[model samples]
Target: MSQGDERGYGDNDPGGRSDDAYSTLGGTRQTRTRMPRGTDDGEGYGRRPARNSRSLVMIVGVVVLLIAAIAFANQGGGDASGDAGEKKPDAAGAGPTAATGTKPVEGKNGTIASGFAHDQQGAQSAAANYAVALGSAEMFDKAKRDAILSATHDPAVVATLQTDMEKAYSAGFLKAVGLNEDGSTPTGLTFVSRTIPVGTKVTAEGVDSATVEVWCTGVVGMAGDGSTKPVTATWFTITEKLKWSGGDWKIESSSQAQGPTPVTGDNRASTADEIAGAVEGYGGFTYAR
Candidate 1:
């Protein structure tokens, strides 16, 4: 979704009030309080207290440490012998951006895609594609959910994750999201729960294991004629710890954090009907690195 529109994760109010301020996927809000200004009654700086000797010493010590740290950093490990064999990342590729145009996985395991190369780039591609599958509406169905778990997660984590997901996507959650207990939307409505990865980064890596973080934007809600839960977007980052298993990268564990969100855009939001039409018209993709 474009900026300036309400960037959020919940249903919209038909009254045109943006309830979009609330995060739908269980997010916490933090508030910062500024220190109040001191009295300005023109006291004319009457009391000039002497600075504490301990505080001054502490400040000097901190400055010394800062200078030392900067000097050490500039030396890049302060070693005479450099690691000439190590590859340095370009400044451009070192930041958040799209894929490096690496080819996607070549195989599919059941409905889920597979056969990713056994490398850091493959780990990123697997994580991106797995994020899409795990965040899809199909995950609400038991059969599809099982298939997804089998395809993405390490065998050791699959059972535990299945139990956890069954609890997380309970009847109460389903109802709140405007889905039936069976995880189906109303006959005329379409349930939207799609994640689009904006970028991926390898956090930690080893010969056979890697941790990849996928920054994502997603939409979730029910779209229909009179639906209160109109589709709305959210921003989050999912970190997947992957293992090279049987010649393919598989997720060992995954966790999600709130966002690297931008300020909301000014675009006008569409109605429920329009949202439904758009969801039906546009199809999702299989993400790759």
Candidate 2:
């Protein structure tokens, strides 16, 4: 995996960075491998003499010694039991506890707006959650959509998005998904447009802004009888250029494209009733890194 350095600035909302636009959203491709069969090994290989048992033993002994030396060094300037020579039982075994407690402040980025810090992990988590929020069914409804846009987007972009989305979720689009003009349930059906993020990464980070990419999988369809389009999943990526604003992370600009998607599964499709029931039964999570 590629890694990069990240930094945070004091409470000041830096504007978006320049390299926000993506030339191509898709990632590099990897070559597929085939496993070797058991019979493919050289015929005479099994007859080779068992090699260097003594050398293996010596290597294991050295490794054990190295571990012991590290433990001893970690105990330095303190009791052998490791608590700065403290006699209390609870304090005697508290070295690891103290070390864990002293762990650095790894604040999350994007989440800082949601009360997270602007750290690498935080940035990734925020990207993932924001992707889910932006792709959710709520985005289809006027009120819920407005709430999400207001919460997650830069104030400047929300107005334009609101206008664009109003047209995008028009009556024709709703009808295509078996929903009413207003993006509501049609009688006995449950309209579902849920986005589940699979993974996230901080492609780049600046002092006051960051570029985050989220790989998301989602199901967008209606769950009801006579619906030709049953619940189906699609994979997509959302890349957001975020800036620190109003004590939180906000999307300065963002874009999305269809996946890095994998082939669809061959499992038997669930019944509409089953799908509706499952949707009602399950609850989604508030994700964090």
Looking at candidate 2, the ten consecutive residues that score lowest on lDDT are 1-10
Error of 1 at 240 (Å): 0.7
lDDT values of the candidates? 0.54, 0.48
Candidate 2 lDDT, 26-54, residue by residue in tens: 32211111223453322211111222444
Candidate 1 lDDT score at position 256 = 49
Candidate 2: stretches off by over 4 Å: 1-113
Question: In model 1, which runs have C-alpha deviations exceeding 4 angstroms?
Answer: 1-102
Score candidate 1 by TM-score against the native: 0.66
Clashes of each: 6, 7
Specify the poorest-scoring 10-residue window by lDDT in model 1: 1-10
